[model samples]
Target: MLIVSQALIPHQDGVTLHPDLFLWDKQLADRKQSWFHAADRTPAEWYASLQGSDVTALLARQIEVMPAATSQCWSVTPYHGQLMRDSIRVYPEGLFPWCSEDAAWLCSTLNPLLAEEGMTLLHSGAALLLSCRDALDAKPLSFAAISGKMLPNRHHEGADGGRLNRLMAEIQMMLHQQQPESRRQRGEVDVSGIWLSNPVAWPQVIIEKKIAVATRNPHLSAIVDGQNATVVISEAERLDQLVKGNVELPKRIVLTGEGYAVLLNRSLLPTFGKPSWSPKRVKSEVELISKLSGWIA
Candidate 1:
């Protein structure tokens, strides 16, 4: 199976992509394709669905399970940013740069504030985990999904909708006040606020075999079962290296992008004797990329 972890760097704005950005252009042209982006979802969310989980619950199984069943757990994503005056848009530059010492310090400063809500920050194996004493049945958007967007207001629907929004607002205020002067002298942006994802749970065991993966994404690598081959992860740029000569590529080819994905395989191929609606064959580089990215024009 070939999982193009990021098949295309897509734009939600309907901007067309250059064909050169497409990977392995000629290699998999003859193979069939079936786009899997019928609903709105990030590539991460789509992959999570394939694992029998959703964006909110995958973390419960992906991260190490703590024995405590009374608390809610989350993987922390501390972002360096400035919330724009627009009141709804966050600077896209708010990407988190993980520095062990810096992250630890930030958590220490913020832990006391989190304690007011019965939450604690834990630095575990390169992951900043958030554990809460009360059950939070709300779904927090992934940072990837909201990179170009803004955090949802408290009115966003969920069981704990109001609290979720309030918590984010509080966190933002705390970060602004607690930012250190050293980082400022370096002309670095403030570690203003955070966007959390991978809401893991307590005491539930997910058993999957170790899988072989090839990618540079740390978050993507952490969730895979390295000891088994059930889940295969690959990068869009390295599809050619993943395929070999004389042998056909794996039947499952998942072309994923920012908020969409397409499943390509022989099963979706047009059959001579059968009559069914099927997407056209990938005859050229233009068609190949356009098909994978859901772009036309």
Candidate 2:
């Protein structure tokens, strides 16, 4: 079984997070393409090697993934001052053998359930930090994604997908109460960017050039201008480079799926942070619940 550890690190302006909050070693055959074998190695240790040196990191203890049926099967009691406090069931009764397709299916099926409770499903893995009001009041919550991009795995892009935007909204709402603003003042903003996975695969100098393009591009100016904007990058190296500069620290930098990303800018970040549901999952569940003999909504 693959043991994954997630961390929620608070930051000066926001929070930094390791999104893979839920991890259990699955049989290697299940992760055929992602087959990783490091004897007694934790997820953090595995990810650390992939990210390289110079990046400070922390790894939490492994959280067991006990498969079960029912609405309350999977639950979490977050630490005091943490964002997660309720139990969230990613799968319903009789839904076992969660595969990559199932993960995607769950994203769409569960989003509405989450929205009903003022929450949503993100397209990335379960790793995130929340920045409320300011740096003094921030929290990070991590979880495993039902489906999304996995490093060293397949890359799939969706058109008009609003997963990132939805995530931004959830974060904003979580922090709105703590970071209230007066009338006529913008509460917060978010700047997000995507980094090419392979660009960093090149030499450091080549990767540096890409960062130059991001900061210099007209499209990126909005990121710097907003009081709260999240810069989402697909490449980790690019994010590391940005931190080295004096640019304002985002409220949260989230590396989701296969993209190196960040969500920040108080007002904008929340707006864009909202998450989207998975269409495939939702459609299938709706059909199953409608046709299954024992199904009840």
Candidate 3:
């Protein structure tokens, strides 16, 4: 079984640490040698590399699979960003609490207005507002692409990137002008703006094994669909219960957002190490995938 978790380690500096994640980090330290350096810096890129899929394709497929669930063809997610001295910093989903109902109401109100500008809006998740352009000429956009340790200078970017950034600013202005009373009543954090993410296309891949996926990330589920796999969607806290059922355990299991891959057989474990730390540098996605190719053989 393989687990891919987000920020399972304190990959970034200055971000507030969660107590539960800190405990998980301690447990992982015992098996530090087993940890794999993420192929890409951000979780979005890492996930895209893992599935051999791009953000645009994934969002397109999601819209096709669940039309009612989304309102756009291109993938752009929203987030609550805070204005700093010189730039804006996006808040991670862990820092805020949002309800589905509020998200739905917000989207409903914004979609109609946004549609006037050749775009449709959807609430991808509590912390994400998904957007897709009505025209096919524009490239897909993502908030994860722009956000990082430093704030983005949207004024000095390429045409496509700049356009997307401008669109994001426009959406934020719209939300601010019409702040929902429901959100205010609930005393939610003042949503300053939105960040876009998952701006790639879904790839077509075939899995020969009877695989099962246990994750809360919709992208993970979309990747495994039509590949003779079972997807169990549940919150992070209740993931164990969701995966531990009476059915036969799959030969291969992937726990997305957990950050570790487990091979059930004893023989394969040693090829890597004793699950203890090594001074080796992190490997790229291609290298890591090549290393694990033997498992399929």
Q: TM-score of each candidate?
A: 0.63, 0.18, 0.60
* Global local distance difference test of model 1: 0.53
Model 1: residue 227 alpha-carbon error in angstroms? 8.2
Distance from true location, Cα of 52 in model 1, Å: 2.1
RMSD of 1: 8.4
lDDT of 2 at 91: 24
Off by over 4 Å in 3: 2-20, 32-49, 64-72, 123-150, 155-157, 200-212, 216-279, 289-297
Count of clashing residue pairs in every prediction: 10, 57, 27
Task: Give the worst 10-residue stretch by lDDT in candidate 2.
Answer: 194-203
lDDT, candidate 3, 1-297, per-residue tens = 433333332324322222333333333333324334332223333344445545445434434333342334454444577778987776653343455565666678677766666555554343233544433334433333333333466443344666666766777888777766877788877656555544432233333333344444433444344243343433333344444433443344322232332222223332442333222344444555555444433
lDDT measured at residue 159 in model 1 versus the true structure, 0 to 100: 85
Pick by lDDT: 1 or 3, better one: 1
User: Per TM-score, what order, best first?
Assistant: 1, 3, 2
Candidate 1 has a TM-score of 0.63
- Ranking the candidates on lDDT from highest down gives 1, 3, 2
Better of 1 and 3 by TM-score: 1
Off by over 4 Å in 2: 1-45, 48-97, 116-119, 124-297
